[model samples]
Target: MRVRDVRAYPHRVTAQLFSLEALGWDDSWRELASAYDGCGDPGRIVRVDRGLFGVATREGLVRASLGGAVLDALAKDAGAAPCTGDWCVVREWCDGPVTVEAVLPRRTAVTRAEAGGTSRGQVLAANIDVAAVVVALHPEPRLARVERLLAIAWASGARPMVVLTKADLVMDADLIAEDVRVVAPGVEVICCSTVSRRGIERLGAMSGEGRTIGLLGASGHGKSSLVNALAGAEVLAVERIRADGKGRHTSVRRELVLTPGGGSVIDTPGLRGVGLQQAETGLSSAFPDIVALAQQCHFADCGHEDEPRCAVLEAVGEGRLAVRRLDSWRALRREAASMGTRSAARRRRALGKRPRRLATRQRETRRGVGR
Candidate 1:
């Protein structure tokens, strides 16, 4: 199957397919194309269910599994594991089973730290251009949560936008917008209502041709409803929130869908918790005001905790800066730093074990030679 044939699918469906740009196909894909000339099939992973994957190819959709070779690659670097929106090469067995051979590179990846206090990062979606952080107005919103998500999104090398969901439930949108502004200053915020179609057009316009946007938020935030409304079809399954106004994980996995206007949207299951790992750069970008203030502090290493002449503390005391915002920034920075240290230690330990294994391998090789 060829790329041209794959493009013949319906425009809406084809938009969800991986493109060479998204796959980082400048020179590496060319190399893979040459190497796998007649040995494998190329496709993009559209959905992942349990251990099985639904891939879109020139011939259509096919279920695929990771072959031994691919699994070995994944073991070497879990980051290389096949993820939704990844372009891969596969070999079709005589029995009609498809095995993933290789995963193409990604231009942009949206990642977050693994939940449950793990230091490892988990890739949510790959090759994304926009990371839309959705927040609902029904539950009165949580600005701290939005800030955390914005930090992760910014760190993922994707443009971050805040989508205020269930806007129809709020009588005073200005108050909600004001609350979000404190946490996500300088970021674009769009109030969208699936019931009223508010800001849907703007949401559609943000996704342009050849661009992929990722939708992220807690469950019951109306993410699936918004996607379905924007797609102009019920392509995704919708679920009702529980009595506590929480989501039921209607969208179980990450899958890309094309908007009726243009571009693509990657909808994912509601996240229970978002952890930060190696997100220092993202934090700095997300809290630029705090970073800027720190530069003017009396001491270079000021912790802003009862430190004399601390600009951040002084600003908070003077009511110029919200204390909650500062606290959130500090908490995230500490968490990210701690996770980074743990991750570094794990890498060092792994590297330390390699030499011992290599020495054992060499001893065995020498014994075999003597025999």
Candidate 2:
């Protein structure tokens, strides 16, 4: 139940990390945590909800809270806030609650633009090695949605693997995977059927001890079943897809679980929006084919709208590239570009730039300065 009884002794903290390597700790973490040596115990944040958090340390899983000072620092830098899969330092500890002093640098994080009318960025999962974009084949794969997730995954600095789930539901899974591959460019497309264990081994092979993989998808996409299948047991709850192909959220929060496959898996609730947070490099990485085509265009900065000799437009017209794919790329590019502008304005404001409201500029002298 509770580990509070053991908090009186500091030795338990080291015991909790006995399996730290199984949770993604390695020589790198030890090296980065050098400065924090003896300051506090090391832990990995497994989940966060409301203001409470579940942190896994060498002592054991401890219920923790961010100290006021640590919270203040993270408020100014959302990127440093604790998320599932963050390596952290617990300076003070008790059985009832532990105090998180600091969060270490993330090796990779799956970030999305905050939804609900916010320009801030939200980190979904941190220190992940693989961003698995899960899609189901029951109805049909949503290529546009896959592209958007791929963009976020690419921007996260982790390798993206497009996992097409529910392969048993489709007769031509390979054909559908090929269709998705055209839009995904360099990303791996795995056709996995939890029912048949089709690509489960391959997926497991990619995950080993000391590695972390994140599962990303929408509801009714069978992300739950896939996660359970990967763990080789029912580590999560699941529900059948409704007749309309929509299902209620099986996972209410992002959580990390140790997989029997020898790595940790972060199971995240289906996202309502895969908003881009100024991911220009992600756009290019996700749509390498289109970027390569543009590089061959007569004008270096061709918008591919109506420019003569536009290779992208030429491909779409020739059926070599689907119009839908090109449209998706353009839409994400425009969104990221708009977000970049807003981010720059926010930076300027933070730097004490004058507000446009009462600021005045010099008027040119045309006939007279007053005129």
After the best TM-score superposition of candidate 1, give how far the Cα of residue 239 lies from its true spot, in angstroms.
1.3
The C-alpha TM-scores of every prediction are 0.84, 0.88
Which has the greatest lDDT? 2
Evaluate all candidate structures by whole-model CA lDDT and list the values in order: 0.79, 0.82
Counted clashes in each candidate structure:
0, 6
Model 1 has an lDDT value of 0.79
Candidate 1 residue spans exceeding 4 A from truth: 1-41, 93-95, 241-246, 351-371
**For model 2, how does the per-residue alpha-carbon lDDT over 1-371 read when each residue is reduced to its tens digit?**
33455546543332243378888888989888887887688888887888667888766876678876679988788777789999988866444446887788888888888877456788999999999998888689888999999999999898899999989988999999999998888889999998899999888877788788898888768777877887888988887546664566768888888777678888888887878974998998999889889998999989999999999999989998889989999899889987888777878887755545334432233335666
Tens-digit lDDT track for model 1 on 1-371? 33434343332233334443432334654675666677687776777778777776655566788888778987888777778877778777775577788777776677878877778888888877888998888778888899998998888788999999888998987788878987787899989898999999899887666567788888878888888987889989888546765446778888877665556788888888888855987898899999899999999999888899999999999998999999898888888889988898988988889899999999999999999
lDDT of 2 at 116: 71
